[model samples]
Target: MSVPILKQGDVLIASIQSALTDRDLLQLKDELAEKVGRLRSRGVVIDVTALDVMDSFATRTIRSIAAATRLRGAETVVVGIQPEVAIALVELGLTLDGIATALDLEEGLDVLVEVMEARRRDR
Candidate 1:
């Protein structure tokens, strides 16, 4: 499985296709962390439509990416979560309070643009 990275206007959109198991999670995590620093803009949209599950480690990696992106003066947004996975996350008592999520790519891009615009003004 390959992770695709695309630049969408002012946003760097990363799509994690196929299954995101613990084995490959960290590789994606590392790449994401690296992108936070290299991104031309401080806005990211991580498309998780293909992800069927979010284990503890994967959740941890997402948290780490969020933290790292924020540290780099950027924001991370998760998009298109599988219904069951969303339910599981809630049952697990996971809090995505600060993390923004979108229902699809279009919405994710909209949110990313808004966040990036706000960041631009602040900086």
Candidate 2:
């Protein structure tokens, strides 16, 4: 299934509504990367609240999505990772290194704002 990616000001929010296949994940990564550049987005929020399970491939793809968007100058935040999913990822030794995470969409956006503000201060 195709994920719905919404643009909120300078941020792109991809809310995964259901379980996705590897192909779907890759497509999401590609689409978000392209949108980050095309829309001049400064941040991205990926909401995985609905997903009950996340395998290594899903975890890796999500990480790659963040990495790919970062290369396009957007900071990515993953929000709403279920408790069970988080535990499974840790058990599998799949880490979401170099990525920011939040409890929900609101918190995720706040994180993005802080990150953007920090960048502005640095500049």
User: Could you give candidate 2's per-residue lDDT for residues 1-123 as a string of tens digits?
Assistant: 999999999999999999999999999999999999999999999999999999989988988888888888989999999999899888999879878999999999999999888877987
TM-score computed on alpha carbons, candidate 1: 0.86
Clashing pairs in 1: none
For candidate 2, report its TM-score.
0.96
lDDT of 1 by residue, 31-66 (tens): 766776776557778888988878777778778877
Off by over 4 Å in 2: none
- What is the lDDT for 29 in model 2? 90
**Per-candidate clash tally:** 0, 0
Stretches of candidate 1 off by over 4 Å are 121-123
